[model samples]
Target: MKNLLVSLADLPAFEEIIDVRTPLEFADDHIPGAINAPVLSNEERVIVGTLYKQDPFAATKLGAGLVAKNIGAHLASTFKDKPQNWRPLIYCWRGGKRSGSMATWLNLIGWKAWQLEGGYKAYRGQVLQLLETLPAASRFIVLAGHTGCGKTRLLHALAQNGAQTLDLEGLARHRGSVLGSFPATSQPSQKSFDSQLTRQLARFDPARPVFVEAESKRVGQIQLPASLMLAIRAADCILVQARFEDRIRFLCDDYASLFDYPANFKTRLSRLVETHGKVVLAHWNGLIDEGKKAELFAELISKHYDPAYKRSSQSNYLRLSDARPLLIDPSGDLNACARQLIVDFAA
Candidate 1:
């Protein structure tokens, strides 16, 4: 505890980051690669707080005992295999007693452990402050297309080839459409989304343009940070062009899991009734009933997605007018297309 304090700026140099906050706090938002080893659990924290409000000295005695027991467990299990020279960065809420106690104990045990100076609060603040100007620093290349155009796939492909790509929907955990929900997977809280995105965005080189798929303000329930949204809207565009049939085929493959949860899919479709009207809904529902999803998908694209995309892109994006077309060939090789895009736009 003497001189064992570190700043958020030094986080990346450390091999391991340990979050000593409660499980819920860690789950809500944490440093991207941090491991959670809570010194005081959620229930224990509440109990200690209540006791301190009631009787300060007695609460300190009980909290000390609990902290010792928990640290023992962590040393025995979590830190059992650590070598003497293993360097770890530890943090808790507000860089208070919790993290201090853990760091002190680990240091006493001969491991080079340092407590985060302002803990998770400081880290969270750094993320917010970093985001304020970070989005403006990097240039963006928007992958613009209608539904089922495989923009996300191509984004990942670009990433695989070492081109900077931000998979927005991947971070949001939704596909950015009416039927965007993934099978049995729940999206993270907004704070968690922000943490992941801030970390992901920071990893990209500011000197290079980042590739990202076009999306609205919200991906499912997760909202994009305002600055990031503005940057994307103002960026250069790469219109991902494929045949209508190719898109439909992509949709069928991409969304095959939706059929497994037929009721959920139908419920999602129902939300669109106000826009498409009852007659169209009835016909689409009938198609679902008759098990003719390909026809339904094709109809939805032609009737719904195409027109909507054209209108929105024309109004919101400045670069769409002179958009460089990145073709999805007959082979449907998105990786090849992504490589070509990187090559074509290597400015």
Candidate 2:
């Protein structure tokens, strides 16, 4: 078998990267494009690990059988159509026996399979280290605005127009607000978020301006990497604006999915009680009870979010007031907005 040991730095050169860790481990984080071909499943790994405490050699024999069966299943199903010359890089936690087995198998089958030297933990270190230094020389153009300005959508629009854009909220799977959540899905673990950020930043050219939406330090459970946040805070900033009516309509539609959970929505509003006062809070709650979503949303934008955003952005951002006029197209013509944003930022 010609399987050679490699490091995380050589990952991109491989055609397919396999994470032979358990499904739960892979779900937590793996190489960006890596497919999971776990040697032991979550339950199976737990069983084997528990058994190991009692009898090490017995555990090995049991693990060997389980690994063999899982590897065979992977070969027959995922690798059934893979050619003899197919090249793959396989890894598991700490570059252990799990990856070694699959790497040997693929190499024996006449394919060029490389085993990662230190596996997922080493790769994670590389990802963290990369985040500490990269997008290294790139200039960032931040789109800062009030709530309901469709900043995230504009970032996507910029991407669609071939401008380099990084959707921070999208990466975190959050909208970076009390009301922002993707009901059925939870945010990735912090490590996973960092890995995802590292992967994207690695792809951008440092010479060009990378567009990103302005956000606070925390987005749901994932905090922005310190280096990345530092870069964003120091980057050139742009003011993204839309008419009040437009913003309301956009927010209503964008967050329409959230309206389904009334109790949760009320709870989110309740958090603002200290700042807005108890009377205002009661009024808002009463609106919710009466299903006066439109009035409630409008009052929230006019009284709560707009004022809060104005103070926060003015104090925190260097260019909020001095920024160029940028009226967002409220009709959801993000494609046009993106084109304009690229041109404006470049200017």
Query: Which residues of candidate 2, in runs, are more than 4 Å off?
Result: 1-3, 108-111, 273-282, 329-337
lDDT of 1 by residue, 1-347 (tens): 48388898898799899999999999999988899999889999899999999999999999989999999999999999998899999999899888888988988888889889998899888888877778888889999988887787788889998799889888888998888877789999998988888878878888777999888989999988889989989999988888889888888888888777667778889998889999998888878777776898999999888888877877888788889877776576767777877887776
Q: lDDT winner among the candidates?
A: 1
> TM-scores of the models, in the given order?
0.89, 0.88
RMSD value for candidate 2: 2.7
> In model 1, what lDDT does residue 90 have?
91
TM-score of 1: 0.89
RMSD of each: 2.5, 2.7
Compared with the true structure, what per-residue lDDT tens digits does model 2 show for residues 1-347? 44699987687799899999999999999888889889899999999999999999999999999999999999899999998789899999999799999999888888889999999999888888898899555688888888887777778888999899888888899988878877788999888999888878888877678998888889988888778878887777778888888888878887776667778888887888889999998898888777766787789899988888877776666656676657788655779878877776663
For model 2, what is the C-alpha lDDT against the true structure? 0.84
